[model samples]
Target: MLREKIFYKDELPVSVITANIVDYPFHFHDDMEIVYVLSGSIILKSGYYTYTLKQGDMFILNDRDMHSLERTDEDNMVMMLQMDLSYFERYYPDLRDQFFVVDMEEDKEENLSVLRNIMAEIMMEILQKGQGYEHKVIESTHNLISCLISDFCYVVNEDGKFQNETGGKTSKILAGRLNRIMDYMYENYERKLTLSEIAENEKLSIYYLSHIIKEATGLSFQDLLSYIRVEESERLLLESGKKIGAIAEEMGFSAVRYYIKHFEQWFGMHPLEYRKRYMGKSMTRESRAKYKRCTPMEIETAIHALTRGAFTETEDKLVLKPVIIDIGTAVGDDDNGQPKTAETSAKDPKEAGIFTIMERSVNDILAEPYHLLMDLGETVLAAGENYVITAEGTDTKDISRLSILVYNYDENVGRSLRKIHTENDLLRLVRHYDDEIEFLIRCNGFSGLYRIYRYRMDRENLAKKLTDSLNPEGGAGKRDMLIGRLTGAPTVTTNTYTSSDVLSVRTTFQGMGVELILVDRI
Candidate 1:
């Protein structure tokens, strides 16, 4: 038995192979494949169907279709054509959910022979690799597909009904019902779901629904649910900056422990460990290093260096002037020095601060005259004009704000342009474009989901324009509008910084984590 191969070589989305074999063990791939018997015969098993493929017989298997074959005749020769679904999707987008039916049992012998001949021609062209062989193979493939559509095949619709009859309506109906159930589960996996609830919604009896689901999927209802949950969790783990616990909760797992247990069982590694391995492969060493966690002093120093001139090692120790804004009086600072309310001090024209990065200790800067300088978390200087600073509140309960402080070196005037209340922990900020700034804010407080926001800066009025949210699932909500989640505050680094074009901000979510989000300036 050979392990399933999910990837193909040579950057080709399609592969054509002619082989002679005695037996082939069960295997699966995330690509559509056609097996055409050129000589002899073979017993093929795919899902619930088992068929004896004689000479000139053809069958098609869809993505994720588990199949195996055993030689019925000694001289078993077959031509297998495998194609990535995404490759065809570019031209045939609607083919995604439609299954190509090629069961020889349901096909006339004459039609089966036509498909076989077309497949043989395609295989020959692929093997010969002559001039214009690629085009010939493609033409032959199209011919075979045309024959299948005209005689042997029928398109399975979204409701699981065959557009053209080839028999097996009952089987198609059962499969369709199971598919609908699976679709429902995928769409609402974030909420608590049960067999009874699903049965009620589908108007099916609990016992019958359970039986059919097991029969159709070869997995019990609970087992299927667990599999879907685990799969979704894996996606979130790699795509979002959400912590393991947050992912477990979002997928409706009873606890993070169960999520970890099932994830490890399916992937052979813990979720966190999987993230690390994934990140190592995807991000470059320089990109990964940009996300290093910097203290408040380090971030402030970086800003100070940028304000003066180009950053250099010798100038890093050069203490610059500090700008202090009296936000405490306007918003009323709490015991931990966070604003008690979410109101911006910019509403009061008189409540702004103006100063420079001074040569003094961070502690000294935080004292009188600079008492209003909040602890900066992540800071970025864009075009050396706009200073975007993310304030890390004293604690998790501290709902912080993102301050876009603009400074004029020649005029010696600094003003807070936008003071938007970030309902969660302020993580990082980077200039996404010339007039836009991006902020990564924590959702469920500290160690939860990290979300990214792109705001267009209004230089004159110091206002922000909400452009778009780019999360796959959708935005978090009005208060958050976070496009995605992260395990924690990521090490963010600016990639492309152009005043006219969009700025690229690359973030490494969590140390040694696999998740990387690239937010582009609008």
Candidate 2:
């Protein structure tokens, strides 16, 4: 009867926790549960299988599964998420019909990282409880569930065996006949379905179809049918006051004794006992007082630790075929000992209008100049006024062009608002901004008609994304969980400029995000 405690949150269908789990007596609920090992290790005994899960490892237990946890040699911090399928399935429909598992034989490091990032965010959301926190938490809960359904759901391979796989194979797994057979079993579990009937429909012999069902699901034909029937009977037993014989007959069991036999085999109890054992004892806000709830600092630590490498998405990169101009060859006045691009070329070189240019930041001269600046190669020079950190590319003296990248780091927002989606949250980030940068760079020695290039990494006001993603009612709570599951890139553009012996370029960039300024010879 031990629950992750959905009743505490009341109407909200998603419950989450980040805790130091010591041990839990064997218990299971109707909600799907996921265990993500954050620190140390955990030992879980679910049904017949016991697994030792280390850091970054995860395990999923389907609805009504009888499972328990045990501590290992090391101390462990686990993040757990439980979703009430009875509420979410009303929208997703097929959500509760599928089983989810992880087979350690397959390499799932990527999947594990993805699962951790989402789980970590969910922990922060609940603990912080910021404005629109409920909406964001539910949205992420849906994302976590969709990942399980699409990525980790059990699937029968071509050989009619359950295998854990990755890389977009859900369609292929479900399209196979074995999947169809499994679907058929769930669809008609309440009614009588014989192997011959299924075989006839598939145009295969009863014997062969029986073999496929066993090999595909790891359960014999009759046992698999009973598995589905007994699992389904839980609702009627708990929801309705129907007598054992009536419920049994309704669930396609010919007699009361047979139904009781299947119920005991699956849930370790008969129907009446299951109801009496769990139904009467319900609804505690805490999963268990002994299970230490994580502090805000702990959750923040976990978020950063998890997002350190694989969790934060790879920065979008752009490979450009730049016109490599050897700046060293630029013609210069012999007396001045500096490149004179303006006098060498027939056309008059462009003046320093861009340096004095206003609001080129929004125009994306080099995209949100702030963030784009940081994103450029590596830190070469950094300085004062509005906290500047500039990165550079290869040496232009030896190569074609000179680039200076600059970006901003706003520490005011903190971890909770790291990935801001709500208008209120974004305003908190935007309102604190001093999004202006004015600097003067006087080109030393060489100078002529040089081109000013803006490398743009497009960063739109993602506030518009909320309109397309979240509903007008501010997300329909768990209904959004029924809704289904990374981009931005860099670009280069050439603008006019003229260089002189003492080329003084004074530029003013205004706005937020990344910016990269590039200079190259004609």
Whose TM-score is greatest here? 2
Local error of candidate 2 at residue 454 (angstroms): 20
What would the per-residue lDDT of candidate 2 be over residues 314-364, giving only the tens digit for each residue?
112111221111122244565567654422332221221222221233222
In candidate 1, stretches whose alpha carbon ends up further than 4 angstroms from where it belongs are: 1-13, 17-31, 37-45, 48-57, 63-78, 84-94, 154-184, 195-212, 235-247, 260-522
Off by over 4 Å in 2: 1-15, 20-34, 45-50, 60-75, 82-115, 133-157, 161-183, 199-219, 234-242, 266-522
Candidate 1, position 497, lDDT = 17
Number of colliding residue pairs in model 2: 21
RMSD of each: 25.0, 19.2
TM-score of each: 0.40, 0.44
Weakest 10 consecutive residues, lDDT, candidate 1?
310-319
Q: Residue 435 in candidate 2 has what lDDT?
A: 50
